[model samples]
Target: MDKNIKIADSMLDLIGNIPLVRLNRIGKETGAEILVKPEFLNPSGSIKDRIAKMMIEDAEKSGVLKEGITIVEGTTGNTGTALAFVSAVKGYRFVAYTPKMVSNKSRMSIMLAYGAESEAIDIQDYNKKMGLDADDDSSVHGGHVELLPRQICLDLERQHDDIWWARQFSNPWNVGAHHDWTAKEILEQTDGKIDAFVASVGTGGTILGVARALKAHNPDIMIVGIEPAGKAMMGAPDEYPLIPGISDGIIPQIFNSKIVDRVISIHDSDAIDMAHQLTQKEGIFCGISSGANVLASTMIAKELGQGKRIVTVLPDSRDRYLEVEKYTT
Candidate 1:
């Protein structure tokens, strides 16, 4: 055998260690020290990469997945793209079920680019088929599609076949991954000095994990959850023009409302406008949800008084939402 040793053999090696950048000019405006966890720096340009890797690795360890298996999950954007990236690297075929409102061209391009497959489901169609009222409980209606994948995957498991279903919304592994990695990184980067943590509620994993970690270090720290106003999904009031980076109507089962100190609801137009401002003024090309979170954080900073340290996540990069921006403009 050769004496030479090799290390860091895969792209997965690049999953974490995202950068932490202090927002200088923005902080000056609010008079609160502001830091942004640039999750877009990840290999897949989103925070979901952390959980995507964890979900896949955990499934493999539990023998729920094996070689040549297919992976499936439900996502609107970032999570699906991250899953596709992971599946491509790990030699597993991947598929995603997204809402019909998601742009087909964008989803297909990203999926194909990462060498994965995807299918967009019409939520209205599923609702009608299941005879669910428009305002009926979402959890009950959410399961209609679950059975489709569960039945197939369960049968494969029974036959000792390899198949993985990454139910991100309900997977404890999803929350655990952030608890272990993302939250830890934030604490380390801030040297345990984070006074306030703000994040938009999607799967709730990010906020739950980060909030728990921050509060453990200092109970005085405030944890704020931001959601889109008027049709917000995470137990918040719902509104129209359902924008990206807000709740998707399905509340994540893992989200812990008690841990959140305050919840701010942002308007879709404001989020879009702020996203534009971020690009124009801050030179940070981020998604609309980042804008929503930033808007919420700024408001919180103003409300809480000056000289506070606030950290938030810039969830995904702007490249994914070019279509939305273009269409709106």
Candidate 2:
């Protein structure tokens, strides 16, 4: 064997080992020692790359995925981008269903670039009319309608001899991916000195993994789950607009409420304001969910006093949200 020839194959090799940066300005401003795990450096420019890899690989291992089968999922942007990236490399067909409120430019561009098919779902007030019932197979929105797939349909597909859904919310693979990879990296980077972890609960996979690992090492470590004030049902909702936080309405099955010590709800405007501040001060351009996490983390730090170490994950890069004013700033 030639020494120069590498054993591993393809761009998939460049998946993990994202950098952890100390946020000096934000830390000082908040009176806490803050560290941010910059996940945008991953292959697909988001933390979802880890879950995408895990879901695909797990499907393969469990014999659910086969040659030429399509990978399908519902996403906003980041997860779809991640799926497209993985699907392109692995030679699988990728299809995504995203809500219309999501930035169209980003969704279309990412799908086109990665050769994935996309369908935009409309964001009607599903709660008031639909009543949490997934039974309405005939819901229509934006003049572009599609039938809602039943649980049986989903199950059949999973059993389908071939296709995989890569459901990020409930999939054990989602939690496992971060628990094995992200958590390990955090421990190594901090030399096992993490006092608390601050993260937004999107799918809840990131915080669950990080908290599990941190608590295992040091049980006293607190895990604070952050959400938009309008959607923070864990705590009292304080009349904030729903923007860039977990407004998906469906609580992920993988999220363990007991594991999370506290939940903080920040206003969307506050998050947007701080996100701009982050770009101006620390030069770290991140998504609004990250801003929510930072806002909550800073609040926690202020409450606990100084000298405490806290880490938060920046879920995606600001590039995805360029059309929004918060990102432009």
For each candidate, what TM-score against the reference?
0.86, 0.86
Q: Best by TM-score, which number? A: 1
Instruction: Quantify how close model 2 is to the true structure by its C-alpha RMSD in Å.
Output: 5.0
Which stretches of model 2 miss by more than 4 angstroms? 1-8, 29-31, 101-103, 122-160, 326-329
lDDT of 1 at 171: 82
Candidate 2 residue-wise lDDT, 131-215, digit = tens: 5443332212111122232232266465866667877767887888888989988898889987789888777788888888888
lDDT of 1 at 25: 65
Task: For candidate 2, report its TM-score.
Answer: 0.86
Summarize candidate 1's per-residue lDDT along 2-114 as a digit string, tens digits: 11325667878887877677776654666787778778877888888998999999989988788888887765577788999989899999877665544335645877799
Which pairs of residues collide in candidate 2?
none
